[model samples]
Target: MRVRLASTDDSPAVAEIYAPYVQTTVISFETTPPDAGQMAERIAATMPAHPWLLAEEAGTVLGYAYAHPFASRAAYAWSAETSVYVRPDRHRRGVGRSLYEVLLRLLAAQGYREAFAGVTLPNAASVALHEGMGFAAVGTYRRVGFKHGSWHDVGWWQRGLGGQGAPAAVRTVTDLEPSELARLLALPGERR
Candidate 1:
C-alpha cells in the first residue's frame, strides 16, 4: 500500500469509507453522512493546517486519516485531534495503521507538539491501534454522546510529538514548499 496526501478528488472515496461508520455505528457521531462536496470543503479547510492522508492499493483508497484543530484558543495551536476511517472490507489489513503512521509523522513535521484521538467506548480495535502507536490513555468522558438509542463513552488518548521547551511558531502543512511536503510523505518508512 502507498500513503500520500489526499486531494479533493479523493473525497468521494473517502466519503464512501466514512458513510458506513456514520450511518450504522457509533464510531462516528455525525448523524448524517457527508456528501463528496462537503468532504471536499473539509479537506480544503483542514489541509491548510494539518494533513489528510490516504492509503491506496491499485488506485483504490482503502483508508484515510487526518488531524484538525484541537481547540480554537491560540494557546492550543500546538495540539491537534486526529481521526481515521477505513473501508469496511479493508479492516484488519493494516490500512488504519499505515494511514495513522503517516498522519502522525506529517503532523510532527508540520510542528504540532501533540496529537490526540478519541475513541467511542467498547471499540477494542481502535483502542489497540492508538495504544500500539504509543498514545497514552488520558481519560474518558462518561456517556458523552447519545447515539443509536444508547449513550456512549468517549475515551481520550494522547501522544507527544517530541517538541520541547518553548514551542517555535507552528507552521501549517500548506506552509511547506511542495517539494518538502512531497519528500515528507515519501519518506522511506511512511508507507506499508
Candidate 2:
C-alpha cells in the first residue's frame, strides 16, 4: 500500500468509502451522503492549504485523511483541523497512520504551525492514532455534536509543526473566508 495526494479522479471512490459512514454511522455529523460532485468540490477545496491524502493498494483506495482550517480568522492561520476515514475492511493495516504521516508533513511544509484533530467519541482506533502520532490530548468537548439520534463528544488533539525556533504561543490563527478555501481547493496538482 502507498499514500499519495488525492486528485479529482479519486472523488468518487472517496465518496464511496465515506458514504456508508455517512448513512450508517455517527462518526461524521453530516447526515447526508455528499454526491460525487460535492465530494469533488470538497477535494478541490482542501487540496491546497491542506493535503487530501489517499491510501491505496493495487489501485483500490483503502482510506483518506486531510486537514482544514480550524477557524477562518486570520489569527488562526497557522492552526488546522484534521479528518481521517478508512475503509472498514482495511482497519489496522497502517493506512490511517500512513495517510496522517504524509498529511502532517505536507501541512508543516506549507507553513502550518500546529495541527488539531477532532476524534469522534467511542473510536479507540482514531484516538490511538492521534496519540501515537505525538498529538497531545487537549480536551474533549462533551456532547458537542449530534448524529444518529444521540450526542457525540469530540476529543481534541494538537501537534506542533514548524515554529521550532519560535515560542509556542506565537502561532498565528487565521479565519479563512469560505472563498479562500474554495480558491485554495482549486489550485493545481498532479491530477492522479
Candidate 3:
C-alpha cells in the first residue's frame, strides 16, 4: 500500500471506514457516524495545523491516521492526540501501521514534541500496535466512557518525538512546501 496526505475529497471513503467503529463498537465514543460533508469540514480544519494521512492500494483507501491538538491550552501546543481507523476487511494487513508511521513522521517534521493515543480497554490489537510503535502506557481512565449500555476504560499511551530543551516554533502542515511534505511521507521502512 502507498501512504499519502489525505485530501477533503477522500472524506467519503474515510467516513465509511470509520462508521462501523462508531456504530458497532466502543472504539470511538461518537454516537452517530459523521457524514462525508462533516468529514470534509474536519479534514479542512485540521489540515492547517496537523497531518491527515491515508493508506491506499489500487486506488482504494484502506486506512487513515491523523493527529490533533492534545489540549486547547497554549502550553499543550507541542503535543497531539492521534487516531487511526482501517477498513474492517483490511485488518491485520499492516494498513494501520503504514498509515501511523507516516502520520507520526509528518507530525515530528511539523515540530510536534509528543504524540498520544487512547485505546478503549480490551482492544489488544490497538494496544499492541501503539506499544510496537514505541509508545509507553501512561495511564488509564476507569470506566470513563459510556457506550453500548456499558462503561469502557481508556488506556492512554505516549511517545516522545525527540523534541527537547528550549521549545522551537511549531510549524503547521500548511507551512511546508508540497515537495517537503511528499518527501516526509515517502520515508522508507516501518517505524518499528
Per-candidate local distance difference test = 0.89, 0.78, 0.89
Residue 191 CA error for candidate 1 (Å)?
9.5
Task: State the weakest 10-residue window (summed lDDT) of model 3.
Answer: 183-192
lDDT of 1 by residue, 54-112 (tens): 89989999999999999999999999999999888889988888888878877888788
> Against the hidden reference, what TM-scores do the models get?
0.94, 0.83, 0.95
lDDT by residue (tens digit), candidate 3, 24-137 = 999999999999999999998888688788899899999999988899999999999999999989899888888888888888888899999999999999999999898999
lDDT of 2 by residue, 84-159 (tens): 9999999998788878877776676567888998877888888899999989999999999888888899888999
| TM-score pick, better of 2 and 3 | 3
Q: Which candidate achieves the best TM-score against the true structure?
A: 3
TM-score of 3: 0.95
Cα misplacement distance, residue 6 of candidate 1 (Å): 0.9
